[model samples]
Target: MSSKLFLGHRLRRLRRDHQMSQTDMATSLAISPSYLNHLERNQRPVTATLLLKLAEHYDVDVRAFAAGGGTRTGPDELAEIFSDHLLADLGVPRYELAELAHNSPSVADAVARLYAALKEAGRNPSLASNDDARSVVTPENWVRDYIQQHRNHYPELEEAAETLGGALSDPLSMQEPMRKRLKNAWGITTRVVSQSELGNISQQFDAERQLFLISSQLRPENRTFALAYQLALVEFAGVIDRMVAEAGAPDEGIRQLLHMSLANYAAGAIMMPYGRFLQACEEMRYSIDRLCGEFGANVEQVAHRLTTLSRPGARGVPFFMLRVDPAGNISKRYAGDQFPFSRFGGTCPRWNLHAAFQAAGQVVTQLIETPDGHRYFTVARTIERPIKSDLSGGLLAIGLGCDIVFAHKLHCAEAYDLADAPVTPVGPACSICPRLDCGYRATPPAGRMLAVDRNAKSISPYPFLP
Candidate 1:
């Protein structure tokens, strides 16, 4: 950790969110307006005592002000973004990028958004048909950014889902009650149908017949989740639509995707009611398997639920989750902190998430140290989800992890001795990784000189000049 924490942007946002002016906020904190200004401008580092004061006064979690201070994007990400040849020649200093992200996260986020648009278009050049070049944000990427902006915690959805969950107790056994509610309340009928009937779709709701057809191929957990999702759509359609309207999604496709995601979030919340699930997580010491049995959810579903425990005052240990296919494409990501994520490529190959594919259905754990020296405890496993009829046999790996500081709270971490754990050296990706001696170097490091010595075969394929 650095001696000074530059969390001016976060503090400023907090103050603005409270509708408090600098002078007012300073007076409340027993600090001068000038000092508060200095703090907001990154002129002075935030102190531990001040962070405690913020928490005490605002009733918020103090962990957001720790380590990198929970910035929207860290310098690591900025560095990775600028490493591309298209932007590398711009000669943006590393500290400037950090200052940009720390002092003005919105602008930093704009940079990231544009980068996303470019990467998405680059990935599918023939499909890029948007003439309005100002913005080409992909549907999934845009919704993902929106979710991250809100910290993946939708208060309205949470409250509504919690209320519904209380009304419908025992999430695992709510299928019948939900079916009844759908039929009685919404005048809709739900029935499981064969794969041939539903075709490629997992679930389909036909409006004309007012019938909901769920694929019989789904597992027990998935079936319950599918029903819960349909119930969420019926129950929270207004709220979900209003959220989409407020989002100002670029197109209808994006709007629909966001709608699906919010409904999915609501369904997850319904299944794992916030208060009870948090209690269970603490009581069980964050055991994935135990929680799976307790909630009747699959590993991937349980892990995804773990990442959304980000309610303001009653927050759980901050955990990041990701889903990756066998081809190393990261399809989903959530939570942000010291963890190094590749902007668009596969994250560090050294991470054990990729290794879990070999040992399907088993949990794999690793103590990983990022290039920037942030230690994390990772829990990864190969998850098998019900696939479309056409694509029947593709396995995805789900990785769930948190900072090493919170590792002790997880039951899975009990096997490792934190004091002397064997740590894996991981980087953001091969394109921007600083390591020059890794035997598994897939590509040369960006923005570094490579040493070409054909006569002497080095251990690393792409040896670089230090």
Candidate 2:
């Protein structure tokens, strides 16, 4: 809680709004022009004396001079950017990078954009050696960026699914109704076949015979979901095609992946028709287990559908969902809000999501705060994948969270005191986390020089140089 302030961006905005030159403002405040320039550029902090002077001279609120009103990019983001292997040899200091982000935001943004482009290019084998061709982007990354930019919600797909749901007798119990609709509307028959008969495919459709085949090894919920997904593909193909066309996906592979994702989205919408699901969520206090039981869906499906409740005028709680294996590898992510997630590295191990694996199939809840001071209420549980013959089944942990402002409405937060709860400070990843005192930290924060002492030992393995 240091009182030292860094309000350079705010001060620059104020001066520009009033159309006052730095020299004029410096003369009015009785400070040198160079000193004023330094303050505006974040080269020097705004001291308490200068803060009072600005408040009195400009007739503004003193609270405006408080810290935390400067940069849009957080220190963790800058840390991650500077930690890139390409810039590792530079050995830049963390405070310097923070200053660059606060003082020169546009330059910081350009660096971020360039880094993203390079990472995307580095994924392709052909572009690895061509520096000039690094600008060429991949269609898979383009589609992922498109989904992220849209916040994982598509109103058009929701509307289409709702319209289709209207034709069914019961949209929530969509298995039987969807089956009837497929048979009557599209003249397609669905059959549950043995794994040996179905070969390697989990699902297949025969156009000539007008038959849909699903492997019998899938769990009942998965079987139903597969059926719903197939119905979406057949019924909402036009809508999915239009979205993919508008996205301008370059390759057929990317197009197919986009189509599959859109189909899954539509299937979720159909299973939990937006309006009914929103009402159920409100009544149940956002309990995933209750929603699953009521809707006849599994926990994973319930959590995934929670992130898609972003319809306008009838929106539910904004949630972020992520799936990671026991090894800490992220398999799926969908954010309906601005929850910063690590893009290239493992998530913070301090999060209870990783601990959910120890108590498999049980839900764990936690109150976590990011380095930027935003707090969230998260619940996690482990999901078991279906086993197939000689292949072993795997487990993935699913985490669902919402901002702390909306925590009181969730059933998971009932046992804890929202106002007095002890929050676990978590970061996007270990590489960028600035929490020096965390006992479980595996690596020193990027851009900081580690001070290792052989003769004199401390609790932390790598004490950062001041």
lDDT (Cα) of model 1: 0.84
Model 1 C-alpha lDDT per residue in residues 308-427, reported as the tens digit of each score: 887777788788999999998788898744346675667888899999999989989999988778889998899886654457767899998899999999998998999898999988
Q: TM-score, each model?
A: 0.94, 0.77
| TM-score of model 2 vs. true structure | 0.77
Provide the overall lDDT of each model, using Cα atoms, as 2-decimal numbers. Answer: 0.84, 0.77
TM-score top scorer: 1
The residue ranges of model 1 lying beyond 4 angstroms of the native Cα positions read 32-34, 68-70, 127-129, 336-338, 388-390
In candidate 1, position 71 carries an lDDT of 59
TM-score of 1: 0.94
Question: Candidate 1: which pairs clash?
Answer: none
lDDT of 2 by residue, 298-345 (tens): 888989899877664566788888898888877787777665567556
Error of 1 at 173 (Å): 1.4
